[model samples]
Target: MNKKLIILLSGLISVGIYMFLPADKNVLKGLAILFFIAALWITEALPITVTALLVPIVAVMTGIFDVREALSYFAHPIIFLFLGGFGLAAALHKYNLDELFAGFIMKTAGSKMIFSVIGLFIATALISMWISNTATTAIMLPVALGLISKIKERNHTTEVFILLGVAFSANIGGIGTIIGSPPNAITAANLGLSFSEWLSIGIPFMLILFPIMVIVLYVILKPKFPDMAAIYTIKTQDVFCNKKSYAVVSIFGFTIILWLLSKPISTWLGIEKGFDSIIAVFAIVLLVLFRTIKWKEIENFADWGVLLLFGGGLVLSGILSETGASVYLAKLVETHLVNYGPFLLVLGAVTLMIFLTEVASNTASAAILVPIFLVLGQEIGHFPPYELALTVGIAASCAFMLPVATPPNALVFGTERIKLKEMMKVGFVLNIICALVISVVAYLIF
Candidate 1:
């Protein structure tokens, strides 16, 4: 179907929902706008940002929020965090710091395919835990592509596995830490859990999923013995590390330290939360102020569309909260799903989130579902609220299926090394495996 027709149909669906629903007008209005936006997001009826921008438009038209309230979401701090992270990444790339780092990693991972796969996957996953998964993927992708190009006897199996090793690891890496992805921060924040608490609970899922992720990719993409010997050894650099690289290392390293120590850092600084974003912005500003990167370069690096998308999603989420739509949905879930027992309920919620994140923006998925899970936990008294929220958050980051599912997916998908069907085929199974792993782990630990 044409995108325009899909968008029009979505608008009609929202209007019809508002007109016919037996709920509060404000709630119905919010739900209508939400369904409209959700449809557009799912169908890509327009550019996601254009669809995102429609949130404020629909909110204003329906009186869900006034112009000021709706427009203010555009400059939300989370959006700034996105900018800061993107800027830092851009700076790193501008200086070829990521390349220097990627070279060092691959050189050390050695010639063997199994160890090389594990090393690259671990490196990407570990970096993703502290930075944007998109950036991590971006940094690793070129390196992977470069390596693939150098292999004179390249075949589909060897090349696909190498590219996917980085991409999949980036996705899985985001699961390990709160700063790893937007969903993690949103989840932890909404649940009132401190960073340490979130990390402790989240790490278990990561441990289980990371190894399985590597094994599954390795097994699926494993090459024949002759082809394995033909695979080129990753090239190395002897003197790439320099003053500039050290600067990248020092600044970024300090930022990670602050993030890992966020609780103590925040306490020492006397703040309630979000020391991580502060570190992100602080790192970006320092990089620019020190002439490490030009201001224009930072602008070039940042993905402003992602920031806009974040704001638009937040605005719609705000409408859902302020208008009582989330609360009503929570009660409905409580009534309908309570009888399944806490484990089953948690499994269901996380499972739903895993798929929802595939169809919508993961960040938006977290913003929309976190509150409902929180409310449901409190009202139904199944899982504790914080745990439920954490489960939803982690599951929100589990969108491993399609290009649109997450930025990391899209970054690697753009390479065209692997078919969409291949990604979907493996992604679908991994989705189930990762979801079940997370849900069961969450039930036990959180």
Candidate 2:
């Protein structure tokens, strides 16, 4: 279908539905705005980021709120957190540190496909716990590509699994902490959550999901390894591990320590927001001040599109809350799900979040839906509001099927080594299963 036609039809459909629904003018307006953006996003009617930027415009023009109120959503501490993380990632890449770490891990498997898969998966996951998953996926990609050439697989199964493992590892790794991914940051920022608190809850979830993801992927993409006896020499030190690089590593560790301790330290200083953004911005400054990174590198490294897209989504989420759209939606869910019990309510929320993430930005999915889940939790009174909030945030980043499901998936797909049908086949099953599993497990744990 023509992208333009899809967008036009979506707009018309939203308007028609709005006119027919017997609801308040403001409520219908919010739905129209949502449907318009969701349709454009799901159909790729525009660049996903561009569609994200358009959402705020749609809401503002539809009278959901005045310009100031809509614009207010874009300003949050998480934006700075993203900038700080991206700068660090760029600096590491510029200094060849990311490659240094990834290479060491990839070499340990010693040319065996299964071990290689596990190694790459573990490497990507560990790196992502502290940096951007997108960056991790991109950094580890060449290793996987090179392995494909060396393996000489006619079926390409081993190579395909290697790349997919890297991407999935990156995605799964983000569930470990508040700074692990944008969705996690958004959740923490909204709830005024501390790093230790997030880790306490999040680490358990990450531990549960990581092995399940690896084992299931291993089974599904069971590529036969003809050269299981092959072993490659591994290196522990290289030119990249020189004095300057070690210094950078030291400063990186310091930044992490600050992030972990910023809350407690700020409490001592009697500050409420606890210096989260302050620490992030301070880390960026120190990296440059110490000559560990350059000014142009900051500009080059920052993901401006992602930052802008997240800002736009924040705008829409604010519209949803202030205009009472989220409240209205919660009431609708309550009417329908009243008898479904807490299990179904939580499961349904998590399941909806997983599928929504497939069609749009994961961060955007979390931004839009977490507020609604919060409202639903309060409305039900028996539901654990915090658990519901965290569930939506965590599950929102679990997209695995389509290339468009998440940036890491798209990054892997762009390599041309993995096919759309292949990802869809495995991803569809995993997506459904993981969503159900996460919801059920979370229900018990929380």
Candidate 3:
């Protein structure tokens, strides 16, 4: 169907829900808007951002929120943090620092095929923590293919292993930091989690899952190793050989240090805590002022739509909270799902999120579900809500069973080297492993 038809159908379905669901006007409106946006997000009848932008519009129309309140979410500090993240990523790219670092990693991984795959996984995951999974995969794709080309044998086993390694590692790496993925930022924003706080969980989560991913892939794909000395032997320039590169590294490192210490820094300076976003914007200013990167060069790197989507998701969360929809939904879940036990409930939810993300945008999945999960977490009374939210956020990045599950997955599949079945074969195991890991870890940590 065309976009208009899908949108009209969505409106009709939401209207039907509004009319049939026995609830207060505010609750009805909130639910209606929720279903409408969820429909659009799942169908993708509209651009993800377009669907996000609709949240405030629908809210105003339904009297859930007024103009000022609805529009204010667009400027939420999380959005700026992500924007600053884009600036940093662009600076790294402009100075060739990212590629330089990636090269050094590949060179060190040695010529063994199995070792190279492990290196690619580690390198992609590390870079993904700092930038984006999508960009990290893009940057690493050529390197993977180059390694594949050097193999004297042409079996698809090693090819799929290497390519999928790049994709999976990118997704895993994004779980390491708040700015590493949109879902992480969404969770942090909702839970008031600082960068260092998230790092406490996220870094460990990435560190554990990436290795499990390697083990699972190694067993499933059982890739054959051949001498890859030709690829690894190439000489590369030093990453910090120049003054410009040095400047970018200093700014990047300084920004990370501040984010990691934002809370202590705030205490020391007598400023407000949770000022990581401010530090992020400040880093952007430093980059430009120092000429490490020009504003024009990196301005376009920010995913403006995703930023708007975050804003819209926040507005939607308001609708649910302000309208008491969250309370109602939490009660509904508690009444029906509480008997499943907290561990199982969380495991099932995390598993569902991973699979749901297979067919939906990970960000959209997080946007739609995190608020509900947050509310559910509070009502469930078994564990902390932020733990649930953290699990959901991390699960959002673990969809690997299909190409549409993530951009990195799709990017690798585009190479035509990996079959749908191959991705599913490997992704299915990883999905199960990750769901269990996230649920168990969140329960244990909190």
In model 1, what lDDT does residue 179 have? 59
> What lDDT is reached at residue 429 by model 1?
81
**What TM-score would candidate 2 get against the native?**
0.90
Top candidate on lDDT is: 3
lDDT at 232, model 1: 34
lDDT digits (tens) for residues 320-342 of candidate 1: 78888878888888888788899
Candidate 3 weakest ten by summed lDDT: 230-239
**Residue 266, candidate 3: alpha-carbon lDDT:** 84
C-alpha RMSD in Å of predicted model 1 compared with the true structure? 3.1
Ranking by TM-score: 3, 2, 1
Q: After superposition, how far is residue 313 of candidate 3 from its true place, in Å?
A: 1.1
Clashes counted in candidate 3 amount to: 0
Model 1 stretches with alpha carbons more than 4 Å out: 146-155, 192-198, 201-203, 225-242, 411-414
Residue range 175-273, candidate 3, lDDT tens digits? 999999998988888888888988988999898899899889889998888755545543334555567888888999999999988998988888775
Q: Lowest summed-lDDT stretch of 10 residues in model 1?
A: 225-234
